[model samples]
Target chain A: MEGALMATEERSAKSDHADSSTGMLELRDIVKRFEKPGQGEILVLDEVDLDVEAGAFVSLLGPSGCGKTTLMNVISGLIEPDRGTMRRGGRDVSPDDLSLGYIFQEPRLLNWKTVRGNIEFALEARDVPEGEWDGRIDRYLDMVNLGDEHDNYPTRLSGGMKQRVSIARALAIEPEIMLMDEPFSSLDEITARDLREELLDIWKREEKTIVFVTHDINEAVFLSDYIYMMNTDGEMFARREVDIDRPRQYDDPDIAKREAELYREFHEHVVD
Target chain B: MDRLTRYLYTVASIIALLALWYVGGVTLPEVIPGLPETYAALVVVLTTPGPYGNMFYFHVWKTIEMLFASLFVSMIAGTVLGVALGRNETLESTLATWIYAWLAIPSLVIVFVSAIWIGFDASSGYFAIPLVITPFVGLNMWEGTRNLDTDLAEMAEFFGAGRIQTFKDVVVPQLAPFLFASFRSGLSIGWKITLLVEAFLLTRGVGFMFRRYFDQYDLPTMMSWLIIFVVFLIVVEYGVLAPLHERVMEWRPEAEGVRVTE
Candidate 1:
């Protein structure tokens, strides 16, 4: 009941953001192709266009090798597209200059560092001005509900906790854009479900732009305000604007029906 | 199997060895001296404080001092050169052949080279050990630093970590075990070579004491000093080397439970 209200609130907020900003990010005719060592050129992304308003939670849904990850990478300025330009805040930003927070599929936490240390490392590199660390670390750890586990090492934490730490590490930098590549794809169903809710809460609290890539249709439907579905060859084949109200519950009828329908749709597309 | 039984077994082994030594020395008078006579000599030498009595401790200290001096000098020089070489493929390839060939050159050759350059002086061992051991240390640490987790390296870079920050935060912490392992091996080799150099070079320490005993035809005194050297080696192995190793390995997060094997 509360989840539905939160979901509605999130949808309205996203709509407002979309209308207010021309677009925080605009992808112009992007194409990415890679050449294998011996194999010929393989087209990964095919003339993709994406518009993401600032502070919007958007999910890119597709099967494996669908170029969803490539698109995210291109948007993050980690990789260059063969023939395209990405404009952020109405200016062309180079890959080296853009500050995009990336969350890998693996936690990628420094094994030697504790959870707090891992988060602090992100700020350590930038000129974050000393003495601002404790407040920032505490704020994010509290958001992830990991305030107690600050001193715990990555090895000691559960997979879900490690992923939460990774998220915290990313958010500590307060990036204009956050790119997550199936960050919860490796976890068990129950933990993944809980983390999805936690992630939505974080997205709500911070209101930072997010681009999430996942093969799971239900995950996309449950979390995303807008779902951009991609084909195996890296084309943005279909897109769905979700209107499910905020704080959405997995058990809600609208969420369940939409999840099932998206699943069927993706399954059919993957099969054909 | 039991702790008490293990303790008893260890005590019994030592008692038996001592008994065999006593019996063998008494039974064969011409071949071996009695335990009493050896003990008498040991007591006289131990009670007297002079060059002979203090020789073993003095020599052990010399060897350790020289070894560490060489190690300290080489580690700084080696790590800097190694990181530079590891990051640049062209430099690595250019220097790889020369470095390996230099490493292959025997310690004896290096000792002779040190003698030629520095002469038979106090600095001989110091010069010799680092020259013999630096290449091996540099190469091993270079490879370890090169093969470090690239994903973590990328993460460091994405966080705007410059060379120094990457080294301190990412490289050092991850490469510590490897670096320490190389240090242990280098230290062992360095000290052994220092002792050999002491025996061959300027004669003032234990090596000089051994030579004097040999000249006087005192085989027992030579053997006693040999025993002292063995005891000194044991002390260093356990007291110094082992503790340092434990300290380094303690940095590992897994060291809390079962012993981490580096």
Candidate 2:
């Protein structure tokens, strides 16, 4: 438990020294609205204000249809909010300049590519130069502990392996900001539990800024440094800063109780 | 029954057909000649190597050459045009009416029209074959390219992939399985249409031989050459196209180790 806090502290200090510009991603007054020509306007998000600090793990928690996805998409530039200012590296940058890393709920792997081929594909697309490819591909696969299944195709992999490959592929590019949208929501419970631990370990190791979106309160409590809980009306109702030391066991009641309490707090906002 | 039993049933059916031919030759004595006559004629023509004997090989070879030439030309032209149409929505929608008009024209009509313009020569089938098959290949491949998984392309974009890299890594690989499937159907249709054109308009190939044999009422010789043509087509289907389809689509999970239509 103490070890994770120490690692986070060391990472913060190291980033403070390395270059303050590398880890900061900020969003300001983001609003996303949708409308049909014959129908009325639909406001998906309204004046959502949030700050993701350098190398901090944050989770956006809410019920279904609460616009956590819209917020993430706006940050990732998949959807353009009606009105907002997004800043990264202390300057207002477009989605292109933000260098966002995204992991969708499904693996979305190219069926034709082998596991290693899939990882190498991102490098090839980014033009990471042929010479550096061998090392970078191997290193990322090793991080996900998928080094052995590098030659297998996606069809041959289990659900868990496919998701791990996805994580490895996302991390390989070394993006300054990682955006995950309910990435583990579809997995078996046991696999999801294992992946959450693996994810935190990887997050600690990489020290990259992560903005994770999930509806699972326990998952948010267990994995996040700060929880930004949103109501169904697209408003950030509460921000819970969990000071629980990490590398804690999943079966611990203290963590479970906190997760339950957070869920109850968020549940009050849901109406009939 | 299993596949082996089904295969044996096909072979047994062929043997039964041959037996019926022999019996009908003896009993009816009025209809087509027996299997022995055609079989004997086949051996004679194969071994003699006369102008007539050698004509079969030449015509077969010429038909294959014309079929391949048209295939090569159409593949390159179709891929370029298909990609363009697929990527551009307005172009696809605008040209769709004309494309359908072209497709609706029959192969025989197209060859007859070409004969009027080109004056019934060896080159007639070559041009006619491409015209007949181009739209088919182009339309199928256009759909294939359009149906490509856009999510993978977005992944490519996230990795800073340029247009060419995204096409090569994401778009092209997905398109390959579809393209091969289209080609399997296209090539067979193209081969058949090329032979029909050769028979109807051209003067120097298997089609010509078939016409000559028909005029002479030499049923044995005509049937022998028809048998040879059928065998050649089977070889092309199994030996050429099936392998090509399997090789190109080897990456697809459903395509792996299992033959299409097996």
Candidate 3:
């Protein structure tokens, strides 16, 4: 298993050069701080650096309070880093220039809007051609297997279905990068597993860059081509290439072995 | 419970209350007028022409007009002001105290002030009712806007929604329940304030008629007017507002025997 991981890492390093030529998304020496009331300032992110190649599915895997979501926010232009530069396509990523789709831990759908309305809102916001709105919305909803629920309000839908709607809404925007912050973490095990498979299928079909943030090691292993493993201190301590093939199952022996090895790696950082 | 059972329970409660009122009227004739007398007075005023023509055609019409006008104006002004105050911290800090202060002052004070300024007329009722209702609506809306789910707004922003778009798509829909809440509460309070202003200052509407009947020692006429107005209020509340509220909030899942009070 170790040799397989090393071999995959070497292959990824070789491909990294080829992918970097396109300059998809780059984060260099990112730092963020927050004020803790009477405690003054606390550093949340410490000089983090990450580069995601175009159309790659990368996961930021760590425990709670590791600033994984914070990093996602910074990348999405929701929050400004205290220091460091974010570049896309070899240029500085301006808030206005970048097109991003974010899936929060919760579905965060507008309760008043039907699933179709939610997708329409995203389409209108992204300035998608008005003539194409219905087609795009129908396509994404069908992709997520929620084509029949377009007229149903979020409150009426089950949690898993609501999350699916969220996925459809995000995808309808046709974003350059999809930032997911533990979008499936709130679901039951079976639902989460099912959605994970659906998400991988979508990624394969759409070929969009995804920066998935999660604490679940198996999820990170199964979904990501490369996993940036961070410590509790909010630093990316290791990067591992998940050599497993596409459509990996949770119960697959190789995926489970990788998850166990990743857990060991995470625990070692905590001990250190 | 099913709709039929709910309606039955409501009707049963109303009948029981009317029975209690009838018993009280018989027990204390000086204080409470008998139902027969009140109903007879209602017939006379409603059918025959009075000093100001038919009481229902003129007085009740004027009062209803004032009630709706003030409600519309206050809803718009209060929602706009509340959204502003909720969004701006500086404005909230500067004006919140004043808003609460205005709310703390009784509607009677506004009625008196408006009467003195605008004179005893239909205009006085209009001015005073909105003054009394605006702060309540504004404060309720302020709370609603302040407690809006920011996560939804963030999602909107990430999808490339601008400020106005986000407010419309995200903020406004979330504020619908609160808007309805303020409207319901405002309607109830506005009617009382309009009547008070009319009784004390204005010489038109049902309130003025009530005052005139009371001054003339016409208990039957006054009790008749009270019954008619109360029934009207009940009808509007259940027929219009209750149905509207149910439709607006139908998307909410039924609570699991858990009561949430604000």
Candidate 4:
């Protein structure tokens, strides 16, 4: 644990991209609206405020129509929030400018490329020094426990294997802020559980800030340091902190207690 | 074992076709030449350097040359037009009807028009095949481009790939099966149109030789020549196309679909 913190300190010191002195990545009063053909305007993200510390895992916990995805999209620069400020260390830059890495809900892998080739595609897109590619790919895929399956194609893989590749692809970019939009939502329960554990492992080892989005309350409880609870009206209604220790057991009494506490709050705000 | 079973099934199919041909030869001896007679005539025709001092190799070479030249032009033009039509609504709406109309016009009529307009020349013959063949290739590509996986394209965009890289890396691979299918049909249709153009217009080609054998009503020689031509197509199919297909789509998992037909 001390070693991971030391690495995070060294990483933040070495890279001038993100400054944590002013509370790191900040999103304040973000507003976005979409116009339907019949409807005049539909407000998706309404003046949302979020502050992410450097090298922390934050999840937006919400139900299906809660604008978690739209906020994620805003962070990734896929769409701009109409009236808001998103700044990295007081600079008017969105999250993507800092070599943003994204993992979609689907694997979204190129079916033609091999497992190794998929990572290579990301590496090329990032223009990471070509010399560093093989090393990064090897380390990330090894971290994801996909070392032996580099030559396999996506179709040949199971759902879990493909999601692992997606994780490896996202991490291979070495982004300062990694955005995941319900990445493990479609997987079976057992697979999702295993991947959540593995994701936490990678998160600790890499020490990169992650903004994960999911509708699963337990998923947010298990994975995040800070869970921003959101409701169906495009508002982040509440926030909670999970203070569980690392390498958390599945049936830890403290985790279940925290989940039980959040469950009531989740129902009151989100499901209602 | 899969390869062996696949080859065995194909061999069985070929034997069944040959048995039917033999029955037809026995039943209609005057019209259909049996394998024995066709083989005999094939030996005679292949051994003789030329038919009546005109070299068969020259005609064969001309037909092949014309086939390649026209197919090259059509494949490029067709794929470009097809992809363009697919990517844009205005282009698709304007040209799709004209392309179908072109496809409906007979290859014979196209050749006649080319002969009358351009005069009987080698250039005219080369130019005529694309006119007949491009529409079919374009239609194949149009359908493929329309069904292209836009999800993959979006993924490419999220990865920060440029337009060129996305088209080359993502779009091209998805459209490859359609491109290859168009190529195969283009080769088949291109050669037939080449024969039509050569027979009516050019002085030397396999199509002219076919016209002669057709005039004489020499069923055995005609069948021999046809069998040899089909052998070339078989060599291309197995030697070139099948291997390329395996390499390109090696990522696809082999599985049978559930029965949908009643």
Of the candidates shown, which would achieve the greatest TM-score relative to the real structure? 3
Candidate 4 structure quality by residue, lDDT tens digits, B1-262: 5889999999999999889999999999987788778878888867777654646566677888889888888989999989999999999898888988899999999899889999998888877898888998899989989998876776777788887888888889989999889989999998888878877887878777677788898888888777767787888889999999989998887675321111
List all candidate RMSDs to the true structure: 6.3, 5.9, 4.3, 6.5
Candidate 4 stretches greater than 4 Å from native = A1-23, A37-40, A269-272, B5-20, B50-54, B256-262
- Each model's TM-score, in the order given? 0.81, 0.86, 0.91, 0.88
lDDT of 2 by residue, B61-94 (tens): 8877888888887777777778788889999998
Alpha-carbon lDDT of model 4: 0.82
| 10 residues in a row with least lDDT, candidate 1 chain A | A1-10
lDDT of prediction 3: 0.84
Better of 3 and 4 by lDDT: 3
Candidate 1 local lDDT, A77-170, one digit each (tens)? 6677889887776787565555578898888888777788888888888767769888989998998888888887777777888888999999
Error of model 2, residue B15, in angstroms:
4.6
Clashing pairs in 1: A3-A247, A6-A246, A6-A247, A7-A245, A7-A246, A7-A247, A8-A245, A8-A246
Worst 10 residues of 3 chain A by lDDT: A1-10
RMSD of 4: 6.5
Provide DockQ values for all models, in the order shown: 0.24, 0.32, 0.43, 0.28
lDDT of each candidate versus the true structure? 0.76, 0.78, 0.84, 0.82
For model 4, how does the per-residue alpha-carbon lDDT over A1-272 read when each residue is reduced to its tens digit? 11111011112321343456544777888988988789888888867887677778889988897789889888887887898898876788755566678899899999899999999988887778999999999999999998988887888788888888998998898887789999999989998888988888778878778999998877888888778877776776666778888778878888889989988877765553
**Per-prediction interface RMSD in Å:** 5.8, 6.4, 6.8, 7.1
